[model samples]
Target chain A: MSGLEGLYQQIILDHSKARHGDGPLEHAAAEHHEYNPTCGDELTMRIRLDDAGERIEELAWQGDGCSISMASASALVDLMAGRTLEEAGERIDAFRAMLRSQGAGEPDEELLEDAIAFHGVSKYVMRVKCAMLSWVALEACLTEARATRG
Target chain B: MEGMSSDTLGARRVADLRLDFPVFRDAGEHAPAYLDSAATSQRPARVLDAEREYLEHHLAPVHRGASAAVGRSTTLFEDARATVARFVGAGERELVWAENATDALNIVALGMADASAGLGGAEASRFALHPGDELVVVEAEHHANLIPWQRLAARTGAVLRPVRVDARGLWGPAELAAVLSPRTRVVAFAEVSNVTGFLAPVAELVALVRERSPEALVVLDACQSVPHRPSDLAASGVDFAAFSGHKMLGPNGIGGLYGRAELLDALPPARTGGSTITRVTLEHAEFLPAPHRFEAGTQPVSQVVALAEAARYLDELGMAEVARHESALAARMAEAVAELPGVRLIGPPPGEERAGLVSVVVDDVHAHDVGQYLDEAGVVVRVGHHCAQPLHRALGVTATTRASAHVYTTEDEVDRFIDALGGVRRFFGVAGAGEQTGVVA
Candidate 1:
């Protein structure tokens, strides 16, 4: 497949259009906003933790950006919902490592789920930031959630 | 090449003009249609050769030491200053070397801030601002022009009065006149807006400032204008103007700041150190006049030489013809892009005059997507708020995709940009027949 085609895979396009969990959360333990100044892409993420604060009850986001960012946010919402905070952190790390690898790192499909689609995004240095925007926000939200738990 | 007459260079076709730039030759068939000259222009062989020739043969510290090498270097540097000054319609003493246009503006602003704090003695007192004194800036100004005034206002206890732009991100002389008052100390604006390609009426605005705020000093952000159009800073009657070399087919790391000779002599140097001083003691130091007073550290000598060559290259081609060519390209891009179904053109409408650039926002698609799509088709363009976030906010779009032209840009390149842009919404599954078919389940 061509690079542009690979970067804009079918799954990524669908997720971007579907935009699951794309509104503000009414009750949330933590929220973080990430802005990509180079392109003016902005994403605001809100997370609601379970009463015990060990699991993510919901992950929601509101943003205006390109397909890569919107799709990444949508995939994050689907992949991290009901997962433990520790597991979410692990996924964030894996996603970040894979994107930073410039298409070198082997992504575990079992672990990454639909986010493996972003493996093609690693090849583009400029677009990598777009794909990683929501993941960065998730990491920040996780940090805020952990602090709130303590 | 310097011996070539203006008629020959001016009459050269766009294809012939493209040959002068080695970048196109090196890239061969793979060279993207370079439409982003508004950001930084590609240098021609003449400019590159000039810089290399200087470094290979005549490398020495300028304006320092009584050595023969120093004298030669100083002579070359001063001669470059004269060439560039004449290009911009300024006397040799009126121009100061700066890191880039941004630094050029900061020198003026910071110097004024110093003046406000009782520096540069009685002469600089003219620039000093009192409490309630106003600094007028336009909303559409690039951050480089706007932020310095913001800091200066904060430092000098001055009020920053912004002349607001319309929804198209354009402000006119009338809007400028509304903001002018006797209390206005400085008026800062761009000659051509980097984002919207709006060509400001400089002389009219300067006249308005004179009528309303006689004491106000007009500062022109000429980063966009000095490159693509005929410029006469002295005739425009502005007190100060700033522009970058890289934007004008010259080497990077060098720019020019044009100030009225008397004003530059009186304004305190923002940075103080070697080369700028005439004599120094533990008590106080005396500085040289005008250009020397502002050039504190070791200079970018080679870049200055190459910049002069770039000026000569443009002069050989004749700026009037250059402007005429680029303006036609801008109109072509604007008129075609305006016809694209789901695209909105920024700045002046199709028939009106603007600079040699066109900025557009695609409906249901971000500028990043549009830029990427254009890139895939080998069409290079600038995409973002373009360092004018406030202007973007005022225009109700986060970013825009801009296609700018220079002397070498051809009709084919503009068509490629427009053709690629037309496919953006469809490819992204936002609109058109392709929206339903291009996507996979």
Candidate 2:
């Protein structure tokens, strides 16, 4: 595939068009806003923790951005919906590492699922922020949720 | 071709002119259509050679030692100042070397701030701002022109009155006149808006400011205009103007700050150090005249020399011819982009006059995506708020994709841009019938 094809995979395009968990969630425990100043891409990520505050019960977002950012948000919802907060944090780290590796780090499909499509995004330094915007917002939301719980 | 008949001077053909720019020559057939000249222009071989020749042969401290090398360096530096000042239609003493256009503007604003704090004494009192005085600025101004005034206002208890732009991200003399008051201390605006490509009627606005607030100093952000169009700072009647070299086929790290001679002499120098002062005591020091007073530290002598070469290059090409070519390109780009469905041109409508740039918003596609698509097609452009966030916000879009031109830009490149943009909606499946499998509703 050409570099542009790799960056804009069909799966990523599909996910962007049919965004999952793409609205304001009611009774959210924590919400965080992330902005990419360079291109003006912005997102508001919301999450609800379970009663035990260990697992993510719900995850949703509302934002305007490119296909990479919107698709990353949708894929994040699919990957972290029912995962434990600890597992989600680990996944965020792995995804960030893969994106920053400049097409070197091999992403485990089992861990990343549809988000492995973003492996090609790692090669383009400018697009890494777009792919990571939602994940960063999710991390911040989780941090806020944990702080509130404490 | 409207102005083409009047002046046959300069390199009339862009194909022939492209040879002078080494980047285009080196890139050969695969060169991306460089449509981002509004951000920074490509340097010509003459400009590069001028800088290299100075640094390789005669590198010395300027305006310092009485050595032969120092004298030669100072002569070259001051000669460059003359060339650039003449290009902008100013006296050599009125132009001061600065880091860039932003730094040049900061010098003016900071100098005023210092004056407000009683720095330059009685002569500087003209610049001092009172508590309720107003500093008028256009809402569509780039952050470089807007933020300094904001900081100056914050420091001097001055009120910032923004002349709001319309939905198209443009403000006229009427908007400026409405915001002007008797208490207005400074009215800062751009000669040509970086985002909207709107060429301001500077003389008209200056006249309005003079009529409404006679004491107010008019500052022109000439970063866009001085590089692309014909400019005469003295004739425009602005008290001060700033422009950078990099955007005019010159080296980075050098720019010009043009001030009326008397005003420059009266305004206090914000930066004070080695070369600017005449005599220093333990407690106080007296500064030199206008240009020297503003120039504090060691200068970018090599860059200044190259900037002069760039000025000569443009002069050989004749600014009128350059402006005519770029304006044609802009109209072509705007008209073509307007024809494309779902694309909204941001500046003056087709058939109206604007600068040699076109900014557009593609429905349902972010400018980042548009830029990536254009990049893949080998059509370079500028995307994002372009450091004019308030203007973008006022236009009800976060960002817009801008395609700008210089003497080297071609019709084929503009066509490529239009072609690439036409496919953006379909590629993203936002327009026309396409695969709609995953849509939630």
| lDDT measured at residue B395 in model 2 versus the true structure, 0 to 100 | 94
Model 2, DockQ value? Answer: 0.69
Candidate 1 docks with a DockQ of 0.66
lDDT of 1 by residue, B22-89 (tens): 98877876689999999999999999999999999999999888999989898889999999999999
Off by over 4 Å in 2: A148-150, B1-9, B433-441
On a 0 to 100 scale, what is the lDDT of residue B245 in model 1? 98
| Alpha-carbon deviation at B394 in model 2, angstroms | 0.8
Kindly list the per-residue Cα lDDT of model 2 for residues B128-188, writing each as its tens digit: 9979999999999999999999999999999999999998888898788888989999999
Error of 1 at B397 (Å): 0.7
Q: Residues A1-150, candidate 2: write the lDDT tens digits.
A: 277888999999999888998999999999999999888899999999899998899999999998899999999999999998889999999999999899996897888888899999999899999999999999999899889888
Q: List, residue by residue over A32-68, the lDDT tens digit for candidate 1.
A: 9999998889999999999899999999999999889
Error of 2 at B256 (Å): 0.7
